[model samples]
Target: MSRRYCLVGNSHLAAPKLAWEGVRAEYPAVRAQFYGATRKQLGELEVKNGAFGAHLRPTSKKVSRAVKRVSGGSDKLKPGSFDAVILFSLGFNFHQAEAIYRTHRTLDFNGSATAEHLVSADCFRAALRSLLEDSLAVKLVRQIRQISDVTIMLSLQPYPSEAILKDGWKGWTTLKAEGDVGLLQETYISAAADIAEAERFDVIYQPVDTLNSEGFTKQDFCENARRLDLAAGDVHPVKNYTHMNADYGERVLQQLFAADAP
Candidate 1:
């Protein structure tokens, strides 16, 4: 019987396509599957691409819908339906916390507020916690456990390119600003810890360390830079950066699968 693996989550998950393309080029015998939120269908295999632009809102029902689609709408697959499941989610929803507060004026002490006042520290923290409970972290854990014998890999996207930052800062400064970055890092670490404590599943850590190797920091990316005219300055990494993410995914997959091989 052929083994199957499923890759799911937001745009960060999309990076694996580049990596998979590389893998296919290097090892044509390997058969794998990828499901992301962007373009649907990979070669002859149909991909349930669920990635949408700024669509990972904590309160959005799409999170659950994505999970359901992957699970075959609760129609039980044969045991070991997926040999592995890789998740590249979290950062976008985390970043969205700030966008949410800014749009809702959640931090406005008075009804009238400036853009600076919209991103207050307290509001950011509140947004982070609210997003955590309602969106990415826990939802991912539950989804992974449902698929039997599946080796689950939870990896985060690299920090956005220096171009994504609003001002010239590495990241936001208010409690909310710092928390947006801090909490997402904490959540990834804590979620890995929680999963390890609870089960035998594999959880891979893809931190900012690799991006740092390029001498890029959150501040560098956020500071003044030419907007990526392609997508109107959305935080998605450009092709070169996406290749970096793909390399990280390839290394993580090799380590995990090699270790598991008998």
Candidate 2:
């Protein structure tokens, strides 16, 4: 019996065509699918590439809407549908806001308010609390629990690399100065903990923090002295970084399927 997997999220969650191609090579027996909003095309397997690109920060309203779309569109799936669903989101909003503030020294909307002034620890927590209440999280949690024999995995995006940060130093520095770094980490850790405690689902924490252990700090990832266009100095992780995520996914699937065995 072949296993089924579905991935849902924003453009950041969208694996480059090469990543999926690599997945196919590694897991020839498993059927993979994608549901997101990216220009890249999946050559085969099933896909619902309708998700829009946005910053999926801790308290994003878009997360709820995207989850709702997934639940409501369940009927579109084949009779048996998905055995496992992977959600890859929640980091964009914080990073984007940081980037904006760093460059302009002000908010994208109100130049008067700087990014440093806008994102406080309290504000980050409040936004995250609101985001967790959105319909999508509720729906997905309900669906996962209600549906028999389905596994739901909520995985966090890898922390931004120093290589990436180097590419966008000004914005990154402003964000750090505003103390958003600690706030962002706290939000993700707290949210993931809350979700895991509340639900019987699996929460896989990538070894993103370990990157720093390996001497790859934010500076290394963010700096773009290489001046390469491919290295778009933004919060989004580069495709190469996906290797860690993909490995995490593979290990997770193996555990889920092994446990499912009769």
Error of 1 at 261 (Å): 5.0
Q: Point out the worst 10-residue segment of candidate 2 by lDDT.
A: 38-47
Error of 1 at 135 (Å): 2.8
lDDT of 1 at 208: 43
Q: For model 1, what is the error of residue 111's alpha carbon versus the real structure, in angstroms, after optimal superposition? A: 27
Candidate 2, residue 152: the lDDT equals 67
In model 1, what is the error at residue 245, expressed in angstroms? Answer: 5.5
Candidate 1 lDDT by residue in tens digits, 33-121: 54443212111121121333111212224533443343335312222446666656544233454355344443322322434455554
Assess the local accuracy of residue 230 in candidate 2 as a C-alpha lDDT between 0 and 100. 20
lDDT of 2 at 97: 30
| Backbone atom clashes (below 3 Å) for every candidate | 17, 21
**Runs with alpha carbons beyond 4 Å of true place in candidate 1:** 1-3, 25-30, 38-79, 90-130, 140-144, 147-149, 162-188, 195-201, 207-209, 213-262
Query: Where is model 1 poorest over a 10-residue stretch in terms of lDDT?
Result: 38-47
Q: Tens digit of lDDT per residue, candidate 2, span 200-228? A: 65665543433564223334332221111
Which ranges of candidate 2 are over 4 A from the true structure? Answer: 38-75, 78-80, 90-126, 132-149, 167-171, 174-187, 213-262
